[model samples]
Target: MTPSYGVRERTAPAYGARWSRERVETAALRVLRWLTVAFFLVVTLVPFYYMVLLSFRSIQALLLAPGRLWPSLGELTASTYVDVLRSMDEGGQGFLLFMRNSAVLAVLTVIATLLVSIPGAYAVSRLRFSGRRQVHFLFLAVYLFPSIVLAIPLFVLLSLLGLRGSIYPLVVVYISQTVPVSIYMLRNYFETVPRSVEEAAAVDGASRLGVVWRVSIPLAMPAITATALYVFMIAWNEFLFALLFLTEDPANWTVSLGLARLSGSIEIPATVLMAGSVILTLPIVVLFFLAERMLTEGLTSGAEKG
Candidate 1:
């Protein structure tokens, strides 16, 4: 009554085939996921690492070994940072001046853009204004238009008015470029706020402006903060206008323009320029991470409500 050997062998082969297919599929998915994540990490992180790595070495090291990923401790140098930050009269790049100018211009642009865009967005969202639909179309059109195109007129006007090489005109230009998109972003977030809360505030004798300031502003703080961060980053990283407007006056040069101009010089080492770049990039990175948490929390809270 013993079973035949072929019978047992046939069943064993089928079972093994099933198990093999399952193992292969699982392994393929795991590999795909890891590959995707690795690609993202490399793309996002490699540039920052390179900036830091290059910043710590001299141009001789970089030129002699352009392919090196990490600098040896013996090659490490902090003199690049000092050389970049010190004043030109002291035989340095004078980037500290550019940093101050950029900070002033970016902060002023953020303040001006937020002041105008906040009210405009609220009006468009809450009021029964005529042409409300066309307003959004106009904002979208303005955003889509090339900054280079606007640069031509702005450049000409600033030159004619003796405002070229000054920070004032650059601030104006930054405000124009940022305000439209800020309005659009703030408008979407405003629309998401419950109308009932505003109505309740109105019942308590709050005026339209009061409702916006007292109720809407507090409720929409996260979105407002996110939009401010967005505008701040835009102003901070702006390069073309900064170059065109401020290149003639080293006193007015932004960090971006200064870095570009300094990097172009044959006498300046690439590592020193890289150090300047890291100095320029660090603030924006810190701000983005801080604001990212607030943005996600705001968006997730809205999503949960629905």
Candidate 2:
């Protein structure tokens, strides 16, 4: 009997071949994943780096050496930031006021959006209301509607009311834009929460409002944080309504509108505008990181499936 290429030898080759194929595929997948991650990081981070790099250099230096990626230590200056933050009366651009205005609008928008969205989301998620199904469709339609088209009507109305150049209108616009999405995100998370927990609370004679306040809100903390941060980012980065409403009043301009307006001017340096871009982008990034941490910690708590 030939022992060659029989049962024992064939089994060894088969095992080796399958193992080799699996190892090769796993290695390829890992490489692909890492490559995709690297690509994302570079795409996201390079523009930020360029903005910071140019922000530290003078307009003269930037013009003289537009292609340079790194500035010499001596070329770096705090003058750009100083010029940006200083008052217009002091011969500076007065972005500090713009920043303050933007901050107030964003904070107010966050508060109002969450206040309205939380109860709305809770109602939609828990209670079997008459218009329950239609509510989501309405929210989706509002969310999907073109903001610019809405802006046209808003602009016309505000202009007629002589409110076009105020931050108040901008805040209201931000809230309207944010509320639909907030309700949607929060409702999804609210639905995922176990109904049994609320029923148990109800058995203890807790009212609907009491249950939401004591039970649902606490349990949905992660989703709340995420929603608030999302609203904040939208309000902070909002440009169209800001431009439409506040462009006439430079004194009341938010950082976004201010940067956009100045971006078109021949008198302002590109490096200066780049500095403004960095300033505009920094706070949202910090808030997002904080929100990400909260979301991670929230998900792992009491998430064991039965």
Candidate 3:
């Protein structure tokens, strides 16, 4: 039985309608994805490019041509960098000391956070202790709380102890801020490790701590590295606690606080401040690129199993 031509044509239009809709939707989504990528790229890269551009140009050039993207060869100078990095005694901004302070605080926070979090994470992941589940809630509570709220009590405690002007108090505050997240990251990775591996180590006369240190830790090194980097970045970039604790002591100022303080000075050049910003941003960029691969692997290690 053959269908009539008119009827066949009408059915053909109906059959193609669903496919046409799907094609339209798919193409729309593809275009939307590219637009999103381009938007974020501009949002993220443009500021850093501008910062670099301004860092190379003098204040006079920038003021005269505020919209210029590139500086002429005659206008480019490294004096801004020199002024930012040299000591105040040398008539510079003394950002070199700020960088040193930031590095010390970040490194110390990473170390201290890891020391507390690693064992705590292992215990939560591997042990069957009383109130183990509730511990995570405690961590979540701490992590969810605003830092500004926590800062008040911390500031008062430090002041009472006469520790307000030292870097050590800032390190302690950062440790509190970072340890909960560190424990969470490490715990997630540690749970993915097979218990059989630790049991095997134990069969060889290794103690519980020995199993954690020698067996489990070696396996979770990637996650541990990622967590350490995360903690370091947080501590390095933190401003509020640094401001509260170290603002009274110029010698103790971290790079973030120093750059902020520089902004308020009418005598300092904007180009020099921009150079200081570049210096402050450079280490984080370098560290991220260096550890990018390890970080990726660590973050995605257990995804396939789920």
TM-score of each: 0.87, 0.85, 0.89
lDDT of 2 by residue, 1-306 (tens): 223233442333658888676557767777798899999999998888999899888999987888888778888987898888888899878889999999999999999999999999998988997988898899989999999899888989998999988887777888889999888778878988899999999999999899999999999988998888888889999888888889988999999998988889898888887888889989988888878765444444345552
Provide backbone clash counts, one per model.
0, 0, 0
Per-residue C-alpha lDDT of model 1 across residues 1-306, encoded as one tens digit per residue: 223224432233658887666557667777788899999999999999999999989888888899989768898999999999998999999999989998999899999999999999898888897898898789889988998998898889888998889898788888889988788778778888999999999999999889999999898887888988888889999999998899989988889999999888999888888989999999999998988876555436436668
Question: What TM value does model 3 have?
Answer: 0.89
Indicate which candidate wins on lDDT.
3
For candidate 3, give the lDDT of residue 286: 87
Candidate 3 Cα deviation (angstroms), residue 87 = 0.6
The segments of candidate 3 whose C-alpha lies over 4 angstroms from its true place after superposition are 1-14, 293-306
lDDT of 3 by residue, 17-96 (tens): 87666557767777798899999999999999999999998899999999998668999999999999999999999999
Candidate 3 has its poorest 10 consecutive residues by lDDT at 1-10
Indicate the residue-level lDDT of 103 in model 3. 95
Residue clash pairs of candidate 2: none
Instruction: Flag clash pairs in model 3.
Output: none
Candidate 2 stretches greater than 4 Å from native: 1-37, 293-306
